[model samples]
Target: MAQGVFAITEQRDGELRKVSFEAVSEGRRVADGLGADLTAVVLGSGIEGLAEELKKYGPDKILVADDAALADYTTDAYTNVLAELIQSSDPAVIITGASAQGKDLSGRLAARLDAGLAMDCVEIKLDNGNLTYTRPMFGGKIVAKVEIEGSPQIVAIRPNVMDIVENSKEPAIEKPAVQVGDLKTKIIEMKMETGDKPELTEADIIVSGGRGTGGDYAAVEELANELGAAVGASRSAVDEGWRPHSDQVGQTGKTVSPNLYVACGISGAIQHLAGMSTSKYIVAINKDEEAPIFSKADFGIAGDLFEVLPAIIAEVKKLK
Candidate 1:
């Protein structure tokens, strides 16, 4: 009988991603409800040490698929190992973070297993004792609930959407043998950008700039660094070459659901709102009180961000 909840933890450069912990916490809740054990699977090279970290958030067991071939993420390698684990465990439910890696791996695994998949789910709940997934639709204008009808339901949860609850369990470690087949693609080299601020998709807080910055990112970057939050940009800011495309948050860019989102001088275009509307708390700062951003913001300040940001920075610094 299929009996446990499984969470697939993603790792890059031998470090577990933030979303991995989020998935494990979510799985722990589901597993406790079902009165079953929760298992966490981490894929990487020389990352068996990460299994102990996952245990802090509570999982009955941790499966580490560590090998040289698994050092870099390859579609074929991760897919094969996960498919093998799923077939053997036959878990009641499988959850992963709806990240680039998560989306890629889960979709392929779903096809391989012929399982129902809920992608980019913002909420997962037990309604009437049935698994239900809630996700945004139509460019964040609407949200819909999804329910997978059978066991081993697969769900890819949106990053930073769920709270990480610590339930501390001494998870037993298992070193699984993953047969990595000959791959069409292999990692030759990997490059990483080490930034002072947090990753946008995984940040608990974010500070974003817009065209009003006049291409001056100094203040915006300072504020973000002060808060230890990620720096994001509006489409206009990116288009104007004030920020890189990677820092853009919007419909045409990346979606972010951080706990606290700060918008500086953004007018809140529909495309921009589509990406960050799911943010838990929004604070907008613009000289124009009539700006569209104010409509969705929890707090609004009418002032020049150039002047206002420094004052806010001063106050934030005083606290430090």
Candidate 2:
């Protein structure tokens, strides 16, 4: 028999990611709907301090695994800790963010636990006390709702899709006994990408460029800096060597759901729209009025990005 809902809260460098809270919020909703308690699982070294912060999102219990072996993320170490926790708790449903780390962890955990896993879910709800998850399929052309046949249902939610609410609940912190007995992998070295702004997948506002900018990222970079937004690039721009593939936003790249998305010089391809069409507000800047991106944008500016971006940047600065 399964117990309740368990949400895996992801943390990096002793700081909790916003997606962690969003997962907790979603898990709580499902737990409430099913008349079950919500429990949060925080795994990593030096993360005991985050227990109080996780409680604010309304979990009934906070499970922390503090150990040196868990400091750096590896599939084997993380999967081992999470698998042990899930086996002991026997949760009816487990949820995690559909991030790079989440996707990797969830798959391995599911395999270890022999549980059905749903990936990249946009929405999760209980239909008459049964868990049903909705996700994009066939290249965002179709939406599919899935349900696990047995107990311990697992899901990985897409970032920025669900609303994260601070319910102000005081969660009881419980430290779980983590068995770190001889992991197969050893982390000898780790390198992290440095950036000033939030990650593109997690940013509230994102400003992106495309080939129409003529390989000069100055206009896009300036506007992004002024707005304190993450910079992104289209497939065309990335392929042209104007930007790195790490910043690419499209079907083949990162999917983002920012509060606002500003697309400059990018002709909106279906592949690109599949990634960021869920953004709350879209502003398109292009010289061609007939561009496909204009149709999806809430605000459209049919003009040269070089001319429009500078003025917009100036206006934004004045307002600030």
Candidate 3:
């Protein structure tokens, strides 16, 4: 039988990612709602310091699995370790970030544990100790609230939807002895993609361009750089080769819940809104006043993006 909720925290480059904190925060809220203990699992190479960092988030327990082979992200290694932990701990709920790495790990963990998984959930709530999850369905046109029917419910949350709150409790650390096994796959080479701004998934502010820019992304890029925002693209722009697929922000692309989302030259499509509509603030710059994006935008600018973007960039630079 399961006892409590556990949040599996993800880390990279020897530090914890923001999504890890978001998972922890979500776990804390769910656990409190159910009157259950909230625990966190930190797995990485040379990560003895992570326990103290996660303790500030009010986790009752911090389970640490540190090993050299676990330094870099490997699907096989992580899946094996997490599956073993879940089998032993028997947590009622397992929450992870719906990030690139998290998505992969959650699905594998679900298969290993034979548990039902709710992916890319925007909200999670516990009703009478039952886990209810809200996830997008049918290309994000509709949202479905589902209840997991088994022990150790698995959930992957979209980044930034949940706020990471700091609690003044010191979490006790427990070092778990993991059995190292032969790997079926080995990570031979690794490449790091460098960008001046933060990743779209993790950025606080995002400025995105679409097909309306007529394949000229200079204005959009300049404005994003001026505002210290990450550059994002609608699926149309990405498919048209105006931007890389990695920069695409839409239901079929990356789902971003940034603090501020600025859409330029992009007509608001339902799929695009599905990814970014949850942002705290949304600003749309387009020539068409009747654009559907303006309906969901907090602020609207009816003008050519080429003209509006430069002015906004100049003003932002002056303010800075």
Candidate 4:
């Protein structure tokens, strides 16, 4: 029988990702509910120092898989090591962040392990000594509750959805020795984003612009800067050549679940909503009162974003 919960953590350049903490924290909660120990498994080269950080998230044990080949993220390399570890450890549940890497890794890992996987889960509940996962389906039109029938249930949770509670446990650290076999892919180069601005998927607050911005993002950037929020764009804005594809928030772009999502100059098409509909609080600013975005916003401002953004920015500055 599977004995414990395993959180497969992701790291880059020997630093722990935000999702790693969330995965471990949520794993801790599930482990406590299931009356099992929680182990966090970190994979990267020279990441042993991360064990102390992982311990603060309440894992009973931390397993570090450090190898030169594991320094960069390659799908086959991570899947091979994790699949072997899971087979030997026999964890009852496996949790990973539903970020880009997490989603990719979990799907391949589940296939290799032949386990049922719940992807992009927003809520995980303990149901009668088992786990039930809630995730959006059909382009965020409907939410579905999913449960796995077999052991070592794999779940990839969306970033920023789970709270990062510090549980602080004196976890026993272990260095897992595993061979990273031949890989089909290799990282030739990496283009790192240059800025302190948080990534869209992990941002706590996001301020986004759309077609209404008229190819000018000064107002949107101003408000986002004042609120310490990441800047996002709709597909129209990106298609219009006003913003890069990385800044787009829509079904075709990145999925974000920030604590606060401010949609400025946006008409809120269904495609755009599919990416950020899971935000905790939504504020929509649009000239048309009947814009679709207003229906989902917690607060609606039926006015031109160009005229409205300065006022909001000023208020945020005053509050700060």
Candidate 5:
């Protein structure tokens, strides 16, 4: 009988991503509910060390694919090997974080295996033998619950959406030598942003600026540093060349589901809301009280961000 719940780990430069643990934690819940074994799969050359770390979160098995070609993630190579693993193991569920890499791999796997798919799931619940996913829809205006039919249901959960739990279970190790050959799409070069602050999507706290900053990120970046929060930008800020496209938080940019999201001088367009409306706590600082941001904020400050940011940063530094 099919009895596996697989969590596909995401790694960059041979290190496991935070969302991989969250997937394992969620997988543990589903495994317990369905009485199936939980397995963690990590793919990269010399990534056995990363796979070994999965034991803390309680998986029944740890499968590591160590190959030099797997060092950098390429769509065709990942899709090919992972598809082969699923076909041979015949898992009941496959969970991956809906990251840049995850979105690509999960969809390809679903198509390759003829499995059902759910994307950007905020919550995963097992009810009446069905796995249901809750996600935002229609530009964050609607909450949608979805379920997939058939075996090997593929779920791509949003980053930071699920919490990881420690169970101290040591999962058995397996090093599968899946034949990974030359691929059509190869990673020639990769440029990644590096900093002490957490990544925008993975951060628990975020401070975002908009057109109101007048292309000055000094105050905004200072506030973010004080709070140890990631920095984000509205589309206007990116368009004005104040922030890079990577920092943009909206429909045209990256989606973030942080614990605390601070919007400064942002008018909160629907496109912007689509990316960050699901944040656990929202604080909006804008001079315009009638700005759309106020409607979604848990706390609203009807004042200039220039004046407000320094005050908040000082208080946060004191508190920290």
Candidate 6:
């Protein structure tokens, strides 16, 4: 019979992503519910030391595929090796983060394994030894509960939505040797995003600007600096050449669920809300009181962001 809850952990540049812990922790919960063991899979070159970190999240065992060819993330290499592992292990459920890498790998892996996949899941529940996933539909207007039939159900969970619980376990670590067949693609060069600010998906706090900034993000950046928050921009801001596409948070861009989201001069389009509506707390600043963002915000400031931002920055500075 198929058994074990398998959590696929993501790592980049030999460091585990924040979502890796969350996937393992959530897998632990499901394993407990289904009376199954939780196993975490980490693939990278020279990443044997990462087992110590995964053990803290309660995996009963960890399979480390330490391979030089698997160092960089490619679609073919990861899918081939992971498919072999899953076929041998026969896990009942497989979980991965909904980050860019995870999203890409899960679909390909599902097809290779002929498994059902639930993408961008926000909530996972165990129902009578089966798993049901809750995911947003139609651009966050509604949520749909999904269930996969058959063994080895695959799920990709959204980042920051799942809590990382520490359930220490003395997991048996195994270094597995697998053949990573010839790859279809090769990385010639990688252009990394350089910044001190936390990644938008993993950030605890974010301050975003919109078309209301009139193409000037000076005040928004200053406020973000004072609050120690990552700077984000709306789609309109990005289309206008005010900010790069990477900085945009919306349906067409990266989805973020920060602890605190401060919207400056944004009119809160539904597409924009689809990304960050799950933030723990929202603060919107716009001159228009009727702006759609205010309806979702915990606190709304009906004033010019230029004037309101400096005040917020000063107050934050005083607190610091």
Colliding pairs, model 4: none
| Highest lDDT scorer | 6
Q: In lDDT terms, how accurate is model 2? A: 0.89
Local accuracy of candidate 6 as per-residue lDDT tens digits, 1-320: 99999999999999999999999999999999999999999999999999999999999999999899999899999999999999999999999999999999999999988899999999998878767899987667678999999878999999988999999999999988988998889899989878678888888999999999999999999888877799999999999999999999988987888999999999999999988898899999999999999999999999999899999888998996
Put down candidate 5 lDDT per residue, 145-219, tens digits, no spaces: 988888889999898989999876877899998777667875567776666779889999999999889888898
Alpha carbon deviation, residue 24, candidate 2 (Å) = 1.1
Cα error of candidate 2 at position 13, Å:
1.1
RMSD, candidate 5, Å: 1.5
State the lDDT of candidate 2 residue by residue for 229-275, as single tens digits.
99999999999999989899989888888999999999999999888
Ranking according to TM-score, highest score first: 6, 4, 2, 5, 3, 1
Name the lDDT value of residue 202 in candidate 1: 86
On a 0 to 100 scale, what is the lDDT of residue 307 in model 1?
A: 96
Clashing pairs in 5: none
Off by over 4 Å in 5: none
Deviating ranges (above 4 Å) for candidate 1: none
**Which parts of model 6 are misplaced by more than 4 Å?**
none
Candidate 2 has a TM-score of 0.96
Model 5 lDDT at residue 19? 94
lDDT of candidate 1 over 167-272, digit per residue (tens): 8988889998889887788577766676556788889899999988888988888999899999999999999988889999988888999989999989999999
Candidate 6, pairs of clashing residues: none
TM-score of 3: 0.95
Model 3 clash pairs are none
lDDT of candidates 1 onward, in order: 0.90, 0.89, 0.88, 0.91, 0.89, 0.93
Better of 1 and 5 by lDDT: 1
| Stretches > 4 Å off in candidate 2 | none
| Whole-model lDDT, model 1 | 0.90
